[model samples]
Structures are given as structure tokens and as C-alpha cells.
Target chain A: MIHVQGLRKEFGPNTVLDGINLDVAPGEVVAVVGPSGTGKSTLLRCLNYLEAPTAGTIEIDGLALTAGQETRKQIYAMRQKSTMIFQNFCLFQNKNVLENITLAMEVVQHIPKERAVDQAREILRQIGLLDKQDSYPSTLSGGQQQRVAIGRAMALHTKVMLFDEPTSALDPCLVGEVLSVIQQISQEHNTTMLIVTHEMQFAHDIANRILFLEGGSIVESGAPDEFFYSPKTERAKQFLQYYSMKRYQ
Target chain B: MNFDLSYAIRQFPTILSYTGMTLRIAIVAMVFSVLFSLIITIVRYYRIPVLTPVVNLYIDLFRGTPLLVQLFFIYYGLAQLFPIFVNLSGYAATVIGMTLNTSSYMTEDMRGALESVPRGQVEAGLSVGMTDLQVMRHVILPQAARVAMPVMGNEFISLVKNSSMAFTLGVREIMAEASLLGTSSSNYFECYLDAFIVYFVLSKIITILQNAVERYLNRRGGAVR
Candidate 1:
């Protein structure tokens, strides 16, 4: 389980996240939706300590992730349990897909080459990229590259996977391929996932719960059924109607 | 006096042997310089507080001073100041000079490459539970090396050409040997022309080698651009 409480992050003068709180049950798929520049991505990055929270406490798997020596060590340790997928893919340009997957395993986990290669192969097959194992990240298409990124994360054996606008960089036709891989991971791998996205229908389909964030805070959250239909807040009602209307015409 | 093509040709083998010596010195200097530069770059990359400032001072001093002055300092001034270095040969001084000079330039090349690697990638490495050194070795250096190769290759070619300066310190590399031949034969033009041609061919070879390495690394490494 991941528990976040009183999360406040300020970038110099601008406060991006203001006293935000949330919990994600193990194996849960929670999709966070928000307007542009609403700090939704920042929130997700903070969860992985990619961006340190200015003030907050994040508890992952019963380990406190407060800002201190002991907590910092635990935060690094906790990273083994969680890995983030960036909007930009962030694949190391120097490595092929196999090296990218196996690097952390070899260096951090100290896994041997044969074992790491075996693990990388299994994950590549799972992500439908077995053929691209030796191919450089540059050689693959955007969707295929994203799948390789997912495979790299899976090779880490993290209990929680975080996706930050995973398909934002893809072409319209390529979006579905990447999303399907994410959906498959959610279905088959049993790894907990938290996705921040703008794809409403995809989020609605895969999310166990949905969070709607506005002005640096989550204003509404609930089961997909309730969050999708009969939204209680006027802002939520306005957003859903606007997006749905855009899709219709 | 008419140009003696046969005479120059007759001296070819002697010139080739000295050319071999020049090549050996350049290559050895490049290897040691790259190692030295990597250490300086790692120190700079980590920003090691008081030590980093000192390293920065070291880089600035080496870069600001001329290579000839550095070579002279190593060969003449330092030996005078220190009795232990009294017997240090011209070849050793040339190697030491070239390594230090190339290291200063290579440090900049490497620094540029390190900067070119996106901040997100470093964050990604750290988020995956890698230590700072691991991120540098496994992630940063490989990528940086690809970016640094073309520039470093240029440095290497320059280093070879600059090996001529070793003549001043009495090293018997190509240029020095040519001068010796020039004095003996009383044929300055032919001897020097022979030395020039040797440098031209070596530089051309270095260019071909640099292009091949750059293309190979690009193909093997990540997305070009």
C-alpha cells in the first residue's frame, strides 16, 4: 500500500502540491486526471522521490518516507518496490533494449549476465517485444519503445509501477498500442499501478478508482463508477461534459 | 640544387621508424590522458566540496597555461627544482606534457558530453536505486563517451601533430629525427618535406579512424540527435 499525507511541494515561489493526501491499496489501479499545469505529474514524480516533497510524509509498504537520513535510505530501498515510467520514455541512449533492462539488475541488484538476460527476455516477451531485445531504443517506433521501457521496469520486479502521461509523446495511432501494454500489465502482472493521463476512456476502463486534481490538489476521488457518472462536484461535472462533448462532435 | 626524389625515397625507411616512434608516443599519451581526464571529470561531476574547488583550480591553471610552457616546466624547471626528477628523459617529459595538455581539453569534451545527457535520465537512474557512482559508470559515462568521441578524436589528431614539439626537448620522434637528418645531409628542404608528408599521412589515417569510431558508436548507441 502507498499512503501520502499532507504533501506540500513548492518550487521556489509557486506551490505545486498543497497539503494533498491519498492512499493506494496494493494491486489497485488509480488514474489521476487533471487540467494542464495542474501539478498532477509533479505529484506522481514526488511519489517516487524524483522530485522531493517540500513537506510531507509518504509511507510505502509500511515504511515512512519522511525527509531524514534513515527515511532517505528507506526511500532508496523503497524504490526497488516502485519504478516510474516517464512521459518522455527516458531510455538510456547508450544502451540497447536488453542492456537498458539489465543495467540496474547487474549494477544495483548484482544479478549475473545470464540470469539478467533471462529475466530481460521473459519480460520482453511479456511486453510483446522479444524480437527487439537486441535492438537499440532509437531503432524502435514510439509505441514499441514505450513497451521496451515498460519491459525495463518489469525487469526491476517493482511491486508498484507509476506511469506519468505514458502516451503523451506518441502519435494518435500509437497511443492505443502503449495503453494496451499498460492494461495488460495491470491485468497480468498483478503489479499496483498509478497512472496520470488525459485519455478518459482508457482511464475509465482500467482504473479501479479515479482522482480529479485541480489547482494543486485532488478535489474529488472515488470508484470509477461514481467518479465517471453522477459526479458530485460542479467542476467535475463541467469537465466530464466538456470532454464528452468534444468527443461527440 | 635540383630536388632529389630518389634521395628522399632512399631515406624512407629511417623516416618510417621515427614515424613509428611518434605514433607510439601519441597513442600512449592519449591513453594516459583519457584516464586522467576521466578522473578529473568524475571529481568535477560529483562537486566534491573543498576538493572540487581545488580540482577546478587545477583545470583552470592547466588550461590557461601554454602546452609548450608546460612541457618546458616538466622538462627543465621541475627537474631543476626537484633532484629526483633530474634524470627524467625527454621522452618521459613529452609524454607527461601531452597527457596533461590533452587531459585539460578532454575534460572539457567529457564535461560537455556529461551535460548533454538529460537530467531525467540521471533522475531515472537514482530512482531505480543506483548509487551516484553506479549512475556515472553504468549510465552517464557510456552515453557521455558516445557524445565525446568526435571531439576527443580531434584532440587525438592534434596530439599527434603536436608530438613534433617533442623535438625541442630532444625526443627522437619523426620531426626531431628529420632535423638530425637535415643537418647531416645538408638537405633541409628534402628532410623537412619527408617529415611533413609523414604527418599528413598519419593525420589522414587518424581522420579515417575517427570517422569509423564515430559511426560505429552512433550505430551501437542510442538515437542519433
Candidate 2:
């Protein structure tokens, strides 16, 4: 479970998040959808303290941190409760795919090498990249690399997984493979997921609930059926119209 | 200015005798400089409080001056100021001066390579629950070392050539031996030509080694896509 309250982020007097509040239940898939620059990515980053919030409290799986009231150690501990997948697929270039997946498990988690490699192989099998295990990230396509990144995140077994536009960097043909992998993982595992993505259709399909953010605030959030079919806010309606028009055309 | 082939040919055995001294000086200086520069690069990368600026000043001072002057100062000037330095061997002074001079340039080379690693890589490491120190040791340094290899190879090759200057301090290296043999035999051309051949061959060997190392690194993996 994850709880956020009064989350505020500021950059040189430019407020990025304005006292945002949210709650996510276990096994919930919440898709954050909004126009660009609406702080969707920043909000996800704040959950893991990747970008420290100017003011807020984040609680995930019993680990809680309130901005300015937490020590660095507490912050690090809180970060361990969650893992993130980036849009650009930032795999360790120096490591082969198997080594990339096993690195954190062995180094950070202190899992024995044999067990870590076994776990990594299992995750690779799940992602259907077992053959590419020995290949470096540079040799993989953007889609294959992103799957490896997803496999790496899955291996951590964190309470929540935050994804920042995971498919935004992929080619049109490659988007389905990555999204299907994400959908399959969410279905099979009871992990809470908060995904910030522009793929409205994928969100409609995968997310049980959708958050509509505008001007750094959640203007409307509800079950996908209500949020997509009958948005209550004028800003959300206009934004969805623009999104649908741009997405289809 | 007769080119005496026989004398030049005969000078090989004598010049070869001093090759060991030159190799020793260059190897010792290279090892010390690489280790020292690694320290400088790490300190500067972390910006370690007061020490960072001190290291910067050290780099600037050594890099700005000629190595010959630095050697003379360490060997001749410092000995006058401190009695202990009066007994400092010319070999020690040469090694100290070359290490100090070469490490300054190496520090900058390594720092640039370290910085060139993308910010995304560090963030990715942190996102995976690795601490800053772990990220540096596991991810950043390995990539930075790969990036810095060619430049480091060039620095080492230059260091080999630069060690020739140590002759002025009477270290009895190749150049010093060549000059002594040249004056004694009155075959300056032949003796100096032999010295040039030795330097050329040594540099070629270093270049070959550099290429082999580069190939090995590339075989490990390509740069981040």
C-alpha cells in the first residue's frame, strides 16, 4: 500500500506539485494520465525520493518519510521499498543482460551469486529474453532492453513499482511487446503499480483506476470506466479530447 | 659529420646497457603517477571539502611548469633549503618530478572521463537501491576507466619519452649514457642516432600494447546506447 498527502514540489518558486494527495491499495494498478508538464513524472519520482518533494509525506509498505523531517538513512530505506523503470531503458552498459539483472541482487541484497543468477534466469524466462542473457544492452533493441529493465525491477520484489513513461521511447511496433509484458506482470503479481504514461488506451485496458492530473493537481480520479467515459471536470474533458484526437490521428 | 656505421653499430651494446635504467625510471614513474592520479580523480569527483581545492592547486602548479625545471628545483633547489634533501639521490628526484608532472595531466584526463558517464546511469543505479558509493564503485568507475584508457595510454607513452629529460639530473639513463659515450668516443652523431633508435622501438612497443588493451576493452562491450 502507498499513501501520499499534501505533496508539494517547487523549483525556484515554480510549483510542480501542489499539495497533492493519493492513496493506493495493495495490488492496485493506478495509471497517472495528464498532458505533458503536468508533474506526472515528478509525482512518481517523489514516491521513491528520486526528486525530493518540497513538502509531503510518503508512506509505502509501513516505511514512511515526511519531507524535511526524515534523515538520509530513512530516505534511503524508504527508497528501497519501491523500484522504478525509466523511459530511456537505463541498463548498465558495461554488464551483459544477465549480469545487469543479477548485480543489485548480489551487491545490494547480498543474495549468493548462484541463487542470484538462478533468480535472474527465472526473470529472463518470464520476460522471454533468456536467449539474450549473454548479450550486452548495446546489442539489444530498445524494446528488448526495456524488458530487461523491467526484469531487473521485478527481481527486486519491492512493495511498489513506479514506471515513468516506459514506452515513450519505443517505436510504434515495439510498444505492444513492452506493454504486454507490463500487463502480464501486473496480472500475475499482487504488486501495487503506479504508472505515468501517455498511452491512454493501454491505461484504459490495464489500470483499474485512472488519475487525471492538470496543473499539478488531480482534477479527477476514478475507476477507468467513469474517468474515461464521463470525466467530471471540464479541464479533464478537454484534455481527454485532445489526447484522443492526437492519439488516433 | 661522418656517419660512422661501425661506431653506431658498436654503440648498441653500450646504449643497451642503460636501457634497463630508462625502463626502470619510466615504469616506476608511470605506476606512481597512475595511482596518484586515481586518488586525485576520486577526491575531485566527490569534491572532498578543503582537499579538493588543494588538489586542484597542485594539478595547476605541476601542469603549468616545465618538467625539467621541476626536476631541477626538486633536486637542486630543495636540497639547499633542507639538509635531508641534500642527500636525495638523483634517481629519487627524477621519479618524484616525473610522477608529479604526469599525474596532473592524468588527473584531468580521468576526471573528464568520469564526468562523461551519463547522469542516467547513476540515477538508474540509485533507483535500484544501490548507495552512491556502490554506484561509483560498480558502475561509474568501470565505465570511466574504459573511456579513459586511450588517453591514459597516450600519457604513458609521453611519459616514456619525457623520462629522457631525467638525464639532465645525472640519473645515468639512456640519454645521459649516450652523451657520455658520444663525448668520450668523439662519435656524437653515431651515439645519438643509437639513442633515437632505442626510443623509437620502445614507443612502438608501447603503442602495440595500447592497441591490445583497447581491443580487449571493446570486446567487453560497446559504449552505452
Candidate 3:
């Protein structure tokens, strides 16, 4: 479960997230879609304190961080509750894939090594990368690397999974494999998810709710069908029209 | 007379006597330089407010001044300027000078290596619930070490060569011993040749060791471009 109240973020003289309030029920999958330079990524990052909110409160899985008063320990605990998947796959280059999946569990969470490996083996089996466990990330394709990244996030058992353009960095051909894995995970587990992505079709397919963000605020919000077909704001309508025109042509 | 092989061979034993002293200075300086520079790199990488600028000042000051001048100042100038350094031995000054000088170059190499790690890697570590220190330890440092290995290898060889400057401060290293032997025996060619051969052999040894360390660091990461 996640609750955000009056979230705001500023970079220098510019305001990025403007006094936004949101609530997500447990197991809800919310996809934030926005044109470039909008605060989709920033909003997701602020929830993790990756970019600290200039003001507001982020409460995830029973841990709440009010902007000004949160300590480092509190921030790390919150990070534990909501792990993130990055576009770049960011696997530790020094570790092979299995070590990548087990590192956070052993080091940060202090799960015993044998237990961590067993859990990693299960995740590797689920992701269908059990054979590639000994391979370093650079040896794998971008899609394979991203799958290992998903395995890393899955191993943590986090309550809220944040995906920031998970498929944006993949080759067009490789994107499907990763999307299917994410879809499968969303169905298998009831973890609440917020994905910031440009894949309109994938968002519609996977997300229960669509949040159309423009100019640093959610201009329109609804179920995927209603939001895609009948947007409330002119900007969102234009945005959808642009996306459609761009897609077809 | 001119480059007498037997004369040079005789001077080898004499030059070899001071090899231990030279190694002592190089090893101490290398260890301290490595420790100091790593700390500086971490401080600058994190941009720890007050300390960042202070270390930047240190790097700039040490790097800008010629190492010879720095050594001369430490051996000769500091005593005049500060009472605390009045009796600082030449041996102590030589170690201090080499450590300070080498660490400046090392800190830059380390900082560059750390920066070469993609920003996303650090964020990934953090998002997985690791603390800042854990991210540095498990993700950043190992990657940075691999990136730093080649250049740091150069620094070690240079540190060995740089230890020659210790002679100017009156520490009896290889160069100093050779000079003393040449002036007394007036066998300058033989004495200097002995020193040259030792330095050449030592650098070769360091290069081999460096290649071995690089292979170790690269063992896991040979595939990265």
C-alpha cells in the first residue's frame, strides 16, 4: 500500500512536482505516462527518496517519511519496503548474475548466504535464467540483463515495486520478454506497483489505473480504457493524439 | 674507465646494500599514499561539504607544486617556519614528501575511476535497500578498483622512481648511495650505471606485478568495454 500527500519537488528555480496527492491500494498497478521533461521519473524517485521531496510525505508499506524530518535509517528502511527496477539493468559488473540476485539479501537484509542462494535459485528458475546464473551481465543481452534485474527486485520481496521505464533501454525485439516477465510477476504476487513508462499499449495492458502526467502534475487519471479513450484534459488528449499519430506514422 | 663492466658489477653490491632502505621508503609511501588518496576520493565523490573543498585544495596544492620543491620545503623550509618541525629527520621528511606528492596524483585517478561507474549502478544499489556505505563497498569500490588498476600501476612505478628524490633530503636510497660511491671513488660511470640497472629491473618487476593485479581485478569484468 502507498499513500502520498502534497508531494512537491524542485530543482534550482524550476518546480518539477507540484503539490501532488495520491493514494494506491495494495496490489494496484498504476502506470504514469507523460511526455518528456514531465515529472514521471521524479515523482517515482521522490517516493523512494532517490530525489528527496522538497516537501510532502511518502508512506509505503507502513513506513512514512515526512520530507524534512526523515533520518537516513528511516530512508533505508523505506527503501527496503519499495525496491526499484531501473532502465539500465545496473547489475553489479563485478558479480555474476546469481551474485547480483543474492547481494542485497545477504549484505543489506542479512539473509544467510545459503538461504539467499536458495532464494536466488528459485528466482532464477522463475525468470528462466538458471543457466545464465554464472554469466556476467555484459555477456548477456540487454533483455537478459534486464531479466536479471527483475530477479534482483523479486528476491527482495518488496511490497511496492517501482519500475522506471523498465523496457525503455531494450532493443525493440527484446522488450517483449521483459514485459511478459513483469506482467507475470504482477499477476503472481499482489505487490503494489508504479511504473513510469512510455509504452502506452503495455501500460494499458498491465496497469489497473493510468495517470497522465503533464507539466509536473497528474492532469488526468482513470482506468486504462477510460483514460486512453476519453481523456479529461486538452493536454492529455493532445498527448494521446500525438502518441497515436507517432505510432501509426 | 669508460663503462667498465667489472667496476659496475662491484658497485652493484654497494648499491644493493641501500636497496632495503629504498624499498622501505617506497613501501611506506605507497601504502600511505593509497590510504590517503582513497579517503580523499570518497570525500570528493560524496561532495561532503566542508571536506570536499579542503581535499580539493590539498590535491591542487600538491599537484601544482613541483615535487622537488615540496620535498625541499619539507626537509629545509618547514623547520624554519614551524618550531614543531625543527628536528624532523631527513628520513621522516622524505616519507612525508613522497606520500603527499603521490597521493595527489592517486586521488585524481581514483576520482576518475569512481566517476566512470555509471550513475545508475549506484542508484540500483541504493534502491535495493543497501546503505550508502554498502553501495560503495559492494558496487562502486570494486568497479572503481578495476578501472583504476592500469593508471595506478603507473603511479607505483613512478613512486619507485620518485623515491630517488629522497636523496636530495639526505636519505641514503639507491640514487643517494650511488652518488656517494661515485664521488668518493670517482668511478661516476660505474656507480651511475649500477643505479640505472637497479631502477630498470625494479620497474620491470613492478610492471609484472601490476599486470598480475590487473588480471585479478579484471577476472570478473573482462567483458566490459
Candidate 4:
């Protein structure tokens, strides 16, 4: 389980996240849908300590991550339990697909080379990119690179996976392929996932719970069916109307 | 006006001996410089508090100064200040001075490489439970090394050419030997031209070596560009 309460983050004078609260139950897929510059990415990053919160508490799997020396260590430990896939794929330009997957295992987990290679090969196969394992990220298509990024995350075997605008950078046609892979992973693995994305159809289809964010705060969050069919706030209605129009055109 | 092939040919061994001395000093100095520069780079990369600024100032001070002045200071002035230690050999003085000089510039080159690593790569390492040091050591450093090779190779080439300045300290390197020969034979133009040719050839050799290293590292790193 992931829990966040009154989470606040500041960048100098600007408040990127202003007293937000949320929770994700185990094995749940929660999608945070918001317009651009709504601090969606910051909130996701703060969950993993990629960006530290200015105030409030985040507890994951019974480990409390607040602001303190001890909490910092706990936050680090918590990040190991959660894997993040960046929107840009973030594949190392210097490494081939196999090396990219095995790097974290060999260096961080201290897994032996033979064993790590075996595990990496298996993950690559799971992602359906075993043939391209020896190829560099530059040689792969956008969708393929995203699959490699997913493979890298899966290799960590984290309990929670954070997808920060996973398919936002992909071509329109390619987005479906990456989304399908994530949907497949969500079905097969027991890992909890929190995805921040712009694909409204994808959000409606895969998210068991949806949080609509505006101006750095959650306007509404509940089962996707409730939020989609019966939005409570005026802000939620406005957001849905805008998403619908964009989809129509 | 007659070109005497035998005279020039006879002078070849003398030139070759001094060239060897010059090459040895440059190679030794470059090795020392690369080691020290890497140390400074690692310190800066990790943002080690009090020491990082001090190292930065040290690099700036050495890089900003004229090498000729540094050579004189290390060879003559420092020696005068401490007579017992002043007995250090000319070869040692030259190597020490060149190493200090090259390292000041190479430190900057190496720091640029370390910084060029994508933030995503560092973040990925940390996300997987690697400490900051481990990320830098195992992942960042190897990637940086590949990006840093071409620039570092240039520094090495410059170091080799700058090694001629050892002649100013009476080290009897190629340039100094050429000066002596010109004076003795009253063939200043011929002797200096020969010295220039030697330096040019050596510079070309370093360039070739740099290209070879770049190709090898590029292949290993899987750099498409």
C-alpha cells in the first residue's frame, strides 16, 4: 500500500504541490490525470524521493518517509521497493539493451554476473525484445525503447511501479503498443502501479481508480467508473469536457 | 649553397638521443597528470565540500599562469629557496613542472566528461538501490570515460609538445640539444628546422594514436554517432 497525506513541495517561491492527499491499495492501478504543468510529475517523483517533499508524510508498505535523517534512509529503502519508468525512456546511450537491464542488478543488487544475465535475458523475453537485447537503444524504435525501459523496471522486482507519462513521448501509433505492454504487466504481475498519463482512453480502460488533479491538488479520486460517469466537482467536469473535445478532434 | 646529406645524416643520432629524452619526460609527466586529474575530477564530481573549491582554485591558478614562468619557478626559484632539495635533477624538475601544468587543464576536461552523463542514468542507478558513489564508480565513470577520451587525447598531445619546454631548464631535451648543435656548427636554421620537423612528426603520431583510441572506445561504448 502507498499512502500520501498533505504532501507539499516548493520550488523557491512557487508551490508545485500544494497539500495533496492520496492512497493506492496493493495490486491497484491508480492513474493521476491532469493538464500540463499541474505538478503531476513532481508528485510522482516525490513518491520515490526523486524530488523530496517540502512537507507532509508518505508511507509505503508500512515504512514512513517523513523529513529526517532516519526517514531519508527509509525513503531510499522505499525507492528500492518502487520502480520508476521515465517518459523519455531514459535508456543509457552507452549501453546495449542487455547491459541496460543487467547494470542495476550487477552494481546495486550485487547479483553475480551469470545469474544476473540469466534474469535479464528472461525479462527481455517477457517484454518481447529478446532479439534486440544486444542492440543499443539508439537502434530501437520509440516503442521498443519504452519496452526496454519497462524491462529494466521489471528486473528490479519492485512491489510498486511508477509510470511518469510513459507513452507521452511516443508517436500516436506507437503509444498503443507500449500501453498494451503495461496493461499486460498490470494483469500478470501483482505489482501496484501509479501511472501519470495524458491518454484519457487508456486511463478509462486500465485504471481501477482515478485521481483528477488541477492547480496542484486532487479535485476528485475514486473508482474510474465513478469519476468518469459521475464527476462531483466543477473542475472535474471541466477537465473531462476538455479531454473529450481533444479526443473528438 | 651545397646541401651536405652526410652532415645532416651524421647529426641524426644526436637529434634522436635528445628526442628520446624529450619523449620519456613527456610520457612520464602525462601519466602523472592523468592520475592527478582523475583524482581532482572525482573530488569535484562528488562535490566534496572544503576540498572541491580548493582543488578548483589550484587548477585555475596553474592553468591561468604561463608555463615558462612555472618552469623557471620550479627549476630555479624553488630550488634557490631550498638549496638541499634544489639538488633535484633537471629531468625530474621538468617532469614535475609539466605534470602540474597538464593536470590543471586535464582536470577541467575530465570534470566536463563526468558532468556530461545524463541525469537519467544517475537516477536509474539510485532507483535500483545503488549509492551515489556506486553509481559514479560503476556506471557513470565508464560512460564518462568514453565521452572524455577525445578531449583527453588532445590534452595528451598538447602535453607531448609542451614537453619541449624542459629544454629551458637545461634538461638537454630535443630543443635544448638543437640549440647546442646550432651554436657549435653555426647551422642555426638547419638545426632549428630539424627540431621543428621532429616535433611535427611526434604531434602527428599522437593524433593517430588518439584516433585509434577514439575508435576503440566508441566501438565498446556502442556510441552510434
State each model's C-alpha RMSD to the native: 2.0, 1.6, 2.3, 2.1
Chain B TM-scores of the candidates:
0.94, 0.95, 0.94, 0.91
TM-score of chain A as modeled in candidate 1: 0.95
Candidate 1 residue spans exceeding 4 A from truth: A68-72, B221-223
Candidate 3 chain A worst ten-residue window by lDDT: A240-249
Kindly list the interface RMSD, in angstroms, of each predicted candidate in the order they appear: 1.8, 1.3, 1.3, 2.2
lDDT of 1 by residue, A1-249 (tens): 899999989999999999989998999999999788888999888888878888888878777676443465666776766889988888877788898899999988999999999999988888888898888877889898888888888888788899999999999999999999899889887788899998998989999999999989999998888988878898988888888887612
Error of 1 at B123 (Å): 2.9
Q: What ranges in model 2 sit over 4 Å off?
A: B223-225
Which residue segments of model 4 deviate by more than 4 Å?
A68-72, B1-4
| lDDT for each residue of candidate 4 in A71-157, tens digit (9 for 90 to 100) | 656766877878889998888777899988988888767889899899999988888999998898888899999999999989888
Query: If ranked by lDDT, best first, what sequence of candidates would result?
Result: 2, 3, 1, 4
Q: TM-scores across all candidates?
A: 0.94, 0.96, 0.93, 0.94
Docking category of candidate 2: medium
lDDT value for model 2: 0.91
User: Considering TM-score, which of the candidate structures 2 and 4 is the better prediction for this target?
Assistant: 2
DockQ of each: 0.61, 0.69, 0.69, 0.58
lDDT of 2 by residue, A8-35 (tens): 9999979999999999999999999998
C-alpha-based local distance difference test score of model 3: 0.90
State each candidate's chain A TM-score: 0.95, 0.98, 0.98, 0.96
Model 2 chain B worst lDDT run, 10 consecutive residues: B216-225
Q: Candidate 2: deviation at residue B201, Å? A: 1.6
Cα lDDT of model 4 by residue, B175-194, tens digit: 89888998898877777777
Predictions in order: lDDT: 0.86, 0.91, 0.90, 0.85
